[model samples]
Structure formats: structure tokens, C-alpha cells
Target: MPRSKRDKKVSLTKTDRKGLAWKQRIIDDIRFCVEKYPNIFVFQVQNMRNNLLKDLRQEWKKNSRFIFGKNRIMQIGLGRTKAEETETDLHKLSKRLTGQVGLLFTEKTKKEVLEWAENYWAVEYARSGFVATKTVTLPAGPLEEFTHSMEPHLRSLGLPTKLEKGVVTIYSDYTVCEEGKVLTPEQARILKLLGDPMAKFRLTMKCSWTKKDGFELHVEDSVDDNQSDSAMEEEPEDDDEKEEMEGDDE
Candidate 1:
């Protein structure tokens, strides 16, 4: 007889079963996170998982949560009804999670979390000593608006900027300032500040005004009532001086 078909089937060993169980446990943890947090960010990284985790724990211990897991498991977790039914969205987002993904969660506002991410990117870029990405020029109007929008936030970080020939330039002696462009130093510093630079800029621009009606105006320099009285008192002294002068002449 030929080799039995049952002999051809590969059975899962005890170790394989145990590994499967551990993976399931991690999936459960991910599901719990999806249900618990409202805002989630998916990050794509390469060869820096351990370092990223360390940096996150050290820098954002109080406000951040991180999880790494299989994309399918994460998508299923995101779909859970206990959460907001984000399965479809997760599926779309999972495309970028192929290489190595580290999900970031925060109890802080979304703005704060994104700001932190931007700062992290800045540090990472500095460590590599190069631009990890290329720049694309936006339309002129939008670029102008964006520059104006970020001005005050830069100012708050003490990184004043000026518009020169349609380019935003940072003002600092320690860092090289170039005409017709915002420099890398300025961009890095702005990211390090970790807030909506545009929002702060808008607020600062709005603050450049006072009420036109002058409701609270006050004057401090009024003539004193004692001025006439002092002049009257001086008249007698002047007459006495005049009489002395006449006597001296006589």
C-alpha cells in the first residue's frame, strides 16, 4: 500500500500550541486597548522597535500607551462593538503597518499627542543627521497662510521668524538663517515645542487689539487747586523785595 494520507499531515507540537496561546493573550490585550482608548495613532517604523519603546516610556510615561501586535488582530480589536466600530478604518490604516508598527495612545488631547510625535520625529532625524523625507512645495496662498499661522508659536519658543521674498526665515545667531526659506533648525525647534503652532499664532494675532470705545481710559495729570493759593502767597514776598530794592536805591 502507498503511504497513508494521515502520515502526511503535520501535527502542531506542544511548543507550537503554547506559542499560539501567548499570541492570543497579546491579541486580548490589544482588544482591551482598543476598547479603552478613543484616539489611536498607528506608526510605521524600521529596525527601531526597542529604541522606540524605550524612548516612549522614558519621555511620555504619564500620558502615553503603546502596543505592538499583528495587524489582523489589531483590526479585529478595532472592530469590536465596545469601541466605535473602527474595523473598516483599521483595515485601511493597516496597510502602512506592514513593516513594523507601534501604536501610540494618549489620555491627553489629540493635539498634544501629535505634537509629541512631531518632536520625536525631529529627534530621530537629528540622530540620523539627515532628512528622512523630501519636501513638497504647497500652493503660494496656503504656504503663506501656514507661515503666518506658525509665527507666534515659534515666537513663544523664542524662535522669531520673518518673511523674506515669500519665504519664512528664522532669526537666530546660533543657527544659520537663510533668506527665502525656513531652516531645518527652526522646523526642529518648532516640533520640539509640541503644540499647535498655528493655533497659538492665531491667538497671538487676535490679541493685538484694544477696545476702540475707550471704556477704561483714565487721566493722571490734572492741575492742582493749590496753584492759585501759592501764587497769592508769593505776592507779599515779591512786594517786600520791591520795597527793599527802592530803599536801597534811596
Candidate 2:
């Protein structure tokens, strides 16, 4: 059904403002990095944690700048289409902007960047409703983390619990989650409470560019070139990308 005149006006006004602001921000970000940094890299991230990314930024802050934004804006920053716009042939790097991508601006050499990838990773706790990567079992024992008052709550979640000598004790071993299965809400909460981390942080270098060289591509053994290299093959190369990768960027 078509919208009434009033509804259309309200929707258009609110959406247009946000859309324009986002585009302008992308343009400014790309321009700033291109003007200041000598090298540009397009990298992919998986299962990334915001705190971890911030830590990485701090680690490389003295020499590098990182931007995770609209891919087109990032592409434009590296001179996506108009080669003459940027000092370097950043347009070439735009071809590999696939998946959860971000740009790294730095004077660091390609070798240094690749070397850093070797050790750049972190592990984090998984949230509820996420699929378990591995089986998680809470063996029958006294759950010291839980107070005696939690015994009743734990029992409601299917854990056979009882208070024993002021400690929350389990009556039998319980399988909290199975590998490749969606984690129950209770399981996720318990895992977090147990301080178990299941999320692995990782980054990948898809391609890099410099003023002298157009783009130097790096392929990881685990990635399939046909698929990985062609992630944006079907995505339109214009400034009018309709959707953006969001939520968990990895």
C-alpha cells in the first residue's frame, strides 16, 4: 500500500538527513586519510570485539590510522573510481573491498603489516543465542561463583542445584551446550558468569597499495580465491550502495 502524504514526508525527512550525514562523513574520512597517510590497506575482520579493536588502534596509533566505515567511502578515500583524485592508485584496492572490511592508513611497509597479522588476534566471550563452536559442559560440582541464593534460579534453568554448606552445588553433570548448536539463553549467561571465552578475534589482509605500486594482493591459505576475491564482484561499484554490513562485522 502507498503511504499517505504526511507519513511519506516524515519518513523522507528523517531518512534523508541521516543518509546525507553518513555520506558526508565517509567522504571526509577518506579524504583525510589519503592526504596524510602514505600506504593504504583493505583488510577484513571476523568476530571482532570493539575493545580489542580499540586496543589495536592504540598499539598502532603512533604510526597508523584505521577506519571501518561504508565500503564505498573507504573506496573513495583510496580513490575508488577516479584514479586522478588520489596521489596513489587507490582505485585498484577498491576491487577487493569484500566482507567486513576496513582501511588502514599508515607509512608502514607491506612486510611490516603482513608480519603484524601473524600475531594480531584476540578471544572473547560469546553471547546468548549464538551457535556454540564447541560443546560446553558444566560438570557436577560446587559452583562457587554462584551464591547459595542462586540455587533456586539455577534449578529453574534445568541445572539440578542445591545449597551445600553455603555453596551452590550441582546434583549431576550437565551439558550446557552442544557444538554446532544454538546456545540456550541460560547457557550463554552461565558461560559468561563462568568467565569462559568462545569468540576468537582475527583479521585478514585482502590487499594493500602504495603510491608507486597500484595494489599488492595477499591471499591467505584458508580463503578461497574464487569466493573471497570476488565478494564485491556482484556489488555495484557506484557511490549508491543500498545496504551496509553491520552488527558483528566479522
Candidate 3:
């Protein structure tokens, strides 16, 4: 008698197995970097901008390495306890790897790295959920910067705009958004169109782990390890962040 088709076992696809393989690859890479580099720094990113970060990575590609995402996987590679640690005092560095943080492995001196981080920052267009830094108001009359076709779009964003002759115009002074309020999608898009950037991307050095001296605290730990892991892959920070092999960046 022939067996039923439902009795046949389905084979797992590459994608089904990718999660474990990806995690293992990241773990191995972290451990490998630990051996290759003498200094490892824990850093937190504020207002992360993917383009700006990619550019910074390209600039530092020659000497430094950055490992981001999967904080737990990184912790496993670095070791979470004294016995499991890859190196002496590495577990301490792993302990502080909570929140939106990444590892920087480099050969640069502590002073040099710290000084560079102090001055490194980029102004970027704010995305949805960010708080408006300042109030924006468009005065009554023709808005020459915008074309007549954009009048509909501006009005849709709650700008109260119309086309006067061939130009987008506002009959009365229009307030786009108020300061200190969380920005909606429309407000963010409008701000971007108006060339107003409210987000600043900056890196803050949290702590450092060195080969000779072991772990040294640069900034006091403010984040809780037990904090909700729901934001581990922060949605608002970078929409396109993904895993890449050492020489191949995304």
C-alpha cells in the first residue's frame, strides 16, 4: 500500500537555520576580534543614523572594528562570568553591554579614542517619535521654496497651505509643530522637507577593556541589565541594520 503524502517529512530551508548560524558567526567573530585587538571599548550610540555610522565605519576600517546588535550573543562571546570569560575582566565589559551599545576593538590609545569620540557627532534629520527641539511657524504669503504641486502635500501634513498663482502659499501664519512634543510621522517628514534636522548622532564611551590593565570604567553604568530586551534591536535607530562578515559591511 502507498503511504500518504502527509507522512513525508519536510526539509528545513536555509532561512530556517539562519538564526542559529548567524548567532554563532557573530559569537566567533567577537572572540576572534578579542584575540586580534589589544583594546576593546564599550560604547553607546545616541540618535543613531545609519548613513553617518556607515561613513564612520568606512573611515575607521583600516585600524578599528565595530560589532553591533545581538548584545546577548556578544556577551556570550565575551563571556558573562569569570569562568566563561574569554579573557581576564572581559566579563565586566560584557556586563555593561546593555541597551543600544556596541563594541569597538582597536589598536588606538585610550586617550586618542576618547578624544575622538568627544568631538565626533553628526546632525541628522529626525525620524518619527523624536521630540521637536524648537517650534516652527510659516508666515502668511507665498512659500517660494515649494512648488504649486507641493501645496496638496503640505496641506496634507497639516500645514494649511494652498496654491496662490503658481506658488504654494499660506493665508495665515501656520504652526507646523511645537517644541518638546513627540513628533508624528507627518511632522517629521515636513521638518525634513523644510531642511530642519533635530537629531544628533553621537557616541559615548562607557568603559574599556585592555590586555594589560584589564577593565577600566570610563563612565558610570546607568543602564539596567535586566531592562526590557524588547528594544535590543531599536526600531527607530536604524531600519536597515544587518549582520555582515568582517570584510563585508552592510
Candidate 4:
């Protein structure tokens, strides 16, 4: 039996409607995020966006899912629920979020995200020649021990430090190893490549067995007074004629 034309048309319309509804549901989810999350950080990748997109695509390929949605839709989606409670005021965050944005929805920890941000900023800082204004305090310890532990790593990175007022101060210009000592362009490049001066120093000390190397050797344990005396006694007698001739020449 042949189906009626009206029945076929009605069935096709129902299928089309269902498809459109599903599409709208996804878009609404994205819109909620954009509207509610005032702290949405818009990283302006610009030229680098393609690289990020490629990485995301690769990850999606492996995981069989990815999120690439319209900003407006995400803004609306964020407003649907309180994604994360914040101590910062919403007004301040809203001002910061007014621009292009790419959403990153992940299960990764905040620390992991912060670490990635730090590494990214490190590269940016190197290219722009920027230094952090923050200073970290170190606990009390032996000056010689501290210097020995840190100096080699700093030297390797071409960054110089000095013990001033019982604290290690990094030179104003990272290009120089000693304070007020100008560094060549190559030195600055090396220092930039070495990121985080303190981390590098700690790693170097641990790898190089600096603690053992820095331990002081006692004179009594290392050498005998009798041996020293015998060695001193073996010194040759001064040739008086030769000494007089040398003195006259001088």
C-alpha cells in the first residue's frame, strides 16, 4: 500500500524540527557560559589561534569530542548557572571580559592551568624584555652554603646575583652576571632561555652534588705538619752569586 503524501510530508517536518531543536539546545548551553561567567579570560591568540585550534582538534580526535562554540552562545550558557564562585567582585571581572574569548572547558586542575599560563608568560616576557617586580624571601641559612648552591645555576643562565644585607639580589639587568657589569647580547639570550632563576639554581645544585662539594675539609684530616715541614725543608738553597747578578740586572 502506498503512503498518503500528507502523511510523508508531516513525518519529514517532524524530523527537521527535532534536528533544529537539538542544535538550539547546544547553542543555548554555550550562551549561558558567556553571559554568566564575568571572569571569562579572552586570550587573543590571533595568529597563534590556528596553532591552538590544531592542538584542540588533535585532542578531540583522540577523545571523540571537542567544544568549539560561538562566543555569544557561550556567554548565554555561562549565565544559566554559577560555574565557579569567586572572591573577586563581578563588576571588576565583567570589565576584564569584554572582548573576544575562547572557552576552555577541562577536567584539569587549576594548578596545571596556572603552570601552563606561567610557561606561556615566561616566553612572552623573554621576547618583550620584562621582569617580575615580586620578590620571594628565603629562610635563614649559611651564606656560603646558599651561595655555593645557587651561584653555578645562575652563572649557567648568565644571570648574576649578589649577597646584599643577607639576601641574594638578582642584578637589575638580567643580561649582566655582576652588578653594573654590561652583558653581551648573547648572554641575555641565554638568560631568557633559562626561565625561573631560583628553580634553575636549585636543580643545578641537586644535580651537581654541591652540598658534598661545599663541605669544608679540615687541615688536620687532610695533611700532616711533619709532611709539610719536610716539603718546606726540601727547598733549594739561594745561589748568592746568581741572586746578586739578578739584582744588579733588575
Choose the strongest candidate by TM-score. 3
Candidate 1: tens digits of C-alpha lDDT, residues 159-208: 54656675555544322222344435555454434321221100000000
The order by descending TM-score is 3, 2, 1, 4
TM-score of 4: 0.27
Off by over 4 Å in 4: 1-25, 28-48, 60-68, 80-97, 120-250
Let me know the TM-score candidate 3 reaches against the reference structure: 0.82
Candidate rank order under lDDT: 3, 2, 1, 4
- Going through the candidates in order, what is the number of backbone clashes in each? 0, 1, 0, 17
Residue 34 in model 4: lDDT: 32
TM-score of each: 0.37, 0.71, 0.82, 0.27
Question: What C-alpha lDDT, on a 0 to 100 scale, does residue 153 get in candidate 4?
Answer: 60
Total clashes, candidate 2?
1
List, residue by residue over 1-250, the lDDT tens digit for candidate 4: 9887777434555455324464466455434433432222223232223334545446534212223333333333333122321222221222222223334333333344345544542122122222332342323333343444565565565445665665555545442333333434444454444442411100000000011132121112322222322242221322111100000000
Off by over 4 Å in 1: 1-18, 46-49, 80-90, 122-250
The C-alpha RMSD in Å for every predicted model, in order, reads 34.1, 7.6, 6.8, 34.4
Q: Residue-wise lDDT of candidate 3 within 218-249, one digit each (tens)?
A: 89766444443343332242322533324232
Best model number under lDDT: 3
* Candidate 2 lDDT over residue span 1-250, tens digit each: 9777776434555455436667776667667767777788888877756667677777777778777766666655565454345664456667667556777878788889989986877887877767899887878889998888888887887788888889999888998889998877788777777788887778888888776575677764343333433243445544232233222111
**Root-mean-square deviation of candidate 3:** 6.8
Clashing pairs in 2: 46-250
lDDT of 2 at 72: 60
TM-score of 2: 0.71
Compared with the true structure, the alpha-carbon lDDT of candidate 3 equals 0.80
- Stretch of 10 with least lDDT, candidate 4: 201-210
